[model samples]
Target: MRLLVAFTCLLAGCLAQKPQPCASPALMTGAFTVTTQNEKLEMYCKYEYDALGQRMRVKQQGTYQTKPFTRDYLLLFREGAMYQIFDTNRTCIKSALKDKFHPMEIPKDATLQGQVVLGSPSAPGQGLLVNTWTGDMPDKKGKYLSTVTEFGCIPINNSYQSDEYGWVVVNLYDNVNGIVDPGQLNPPDFCRDTVMKTDEEPKNFLSLFHNLP
Candidate 1:
């Protein structure tokens, strides 16, 4: 089955952070799977952050084991713009959102939740910090959008969209702490050409990463 990658189109400034939130600029590589009575779909992803605590790059690739077709795409966020690279056809699209960072933006009136849970006792004073919130956003047309999100303090469990994917759960198996290879954040030569809307481009690819997911 074709996986429907869904996420919020973030277009706002930074949401206020609670004290001692999870560390960032780390690498989170994992899979998002959705299963229902009638269909099942899965996608693998690698998310990277820059030293400045920003989501600098993300690459997602996957396909059904029995299918011949595959989907692969990379998104680079920097310089106040978002760059997309479609792996199948080596096409690039650019969107200048003028926002440097794209973490999910929580509404001003969103409900807040968090706690300081202790970690391993051996590591004294070390504890797990968690922040979860939910809120609603009305689009320009006045359509209300609802979202739920969770963030980890240690960056171990990290963060994921609780509401973006219906019946989908994001499980991250590998968490790498270090600087990401510069090459991974750069657009390849094939994608350096002018942007063009071709018939082969995936419609949701750009829409998903338009904000900070």
Candidate 2:
């Protein structure tokens, strides 16, 4: 009888329903480190996101080609403009924004790998419950794995790999629920004299890093 009961409990656990899909907060501020194998590049960036308004801003500092550089990007999807500011040269370039706003949430089509505790589960209030999800990228050109907190849907880290870009990983931390400053969404003052690059085709945020000199 005891053996039968144990087997039944195990089966029930295995058949438990998966968690529902959850979206991240509409507004947020966070810092993330990005590394790419193809470019051999690493960057630390602070970002502000406004999902509801379809806007985002990122300030990144990193070394590329053995040269230290600081760049800021303001992507305004609603306005259909993207501003790229090079702090090292005090120059700004504007281009048409082509990427759609992507919220910081696990894709609904992603397969759940499993759930695990990030810290010691035995200690109360010390462990974080997180879920891992994997899926094909939207373009179907790559595969991605993402880890996020189960309770609040906060992103922890994400990794993507493809034949084109090799592997790119982003580790997110110091995230807060709402925008720290609305002003961060605006283009920097240095961009006042920016000129639109009419001949250059628009590229997404990640593509910009891959093309960095």
Candidate 3:
């Protein structure tokens, strides 16, 4: 009787599939590079997480060029603050983060559109594509700051990842996963002698990558 009951329980467990957790930062650790279709706009980024799986540090560096103009910069984020080091002006700017940023996750109420294979069609891994219409994410001030009308996400290996947003399409490659040195997150002392920016500066470095008319 014991063997029969155990076998029945195992069969029932296999029949009922449990819902997987959304793309929580707990699953993401280590380093990744943010790259675009054009190599000239490639950006290197590294992510460091604490014991609780919350992001503790981030280091990003890249060179942005548009024809005759080019600018190189290094960005570091940690302890609820961001530091930007510009190579052209030899200046370091600091900005404080008002709220903690949680990576986008697929909502429980999302509508499943379909499933698609990432990378190539013959790839062994597949992703579930979902769309959230009523879900609108506001900026820090509770004001609707983004023009992104459609919110789409693909959950692969139980993680919400997307390759395209608005008019930008890029690939995220994470090949490094290990301990990050503490010194990498620190700004040089020379930056202190240079110009300093207040916390009210622009929030993102989007303007560095492109030239808007």
Find the candidate with the highest lDDT and give its number.
2
RMSD of each: 12.5, 5.5, 9.0
The best candidate in terms of TM-score: 2
lDDT of candidates 1 onward, in order:
0.41, 0.82, 0.39
How many clashing pairs does model 1 include? Answer: 2
* Ranking 1 against 3 by lDDT, winner: 1
Write model 1 residue lDDT over 92-173, tens digit each, in one string. 7765533335443444665555433435322323433344543342323222222222333223232223333333334444
Q: How good is model 3 by TM-score?
A: 0.45
Report the error of model 1 at residue 53, Å. 10
lDDT of 2 by residue, 80-137 (tens): 7898877677778899877887888887789988887788454445567778899999
Q: Model 1, stretches more than 4 Å misplaced?
A: 1-39, 51-55, 63-70, 76-101, 104-110, 116-129, 137-167, 176-178, 198-213
lDDT by residue (tens digit), candidate 3, 25-122: 33333544444444444455554544243334555555444323323333333344455556556567665534454553544554344332223322
Decoy 2 TM-score against native: 0.85
**Ten residues in sequence with the least summed lDDT for candidate 3:** 142-151
TM-score of each: 0.48, 0.85, 0.45
TM-score preference between candidates 2 and 3, better one: 2
> Which stretches of candidate 2 lie above 4 Å from their native place?
1-17, 86-91, 189-195
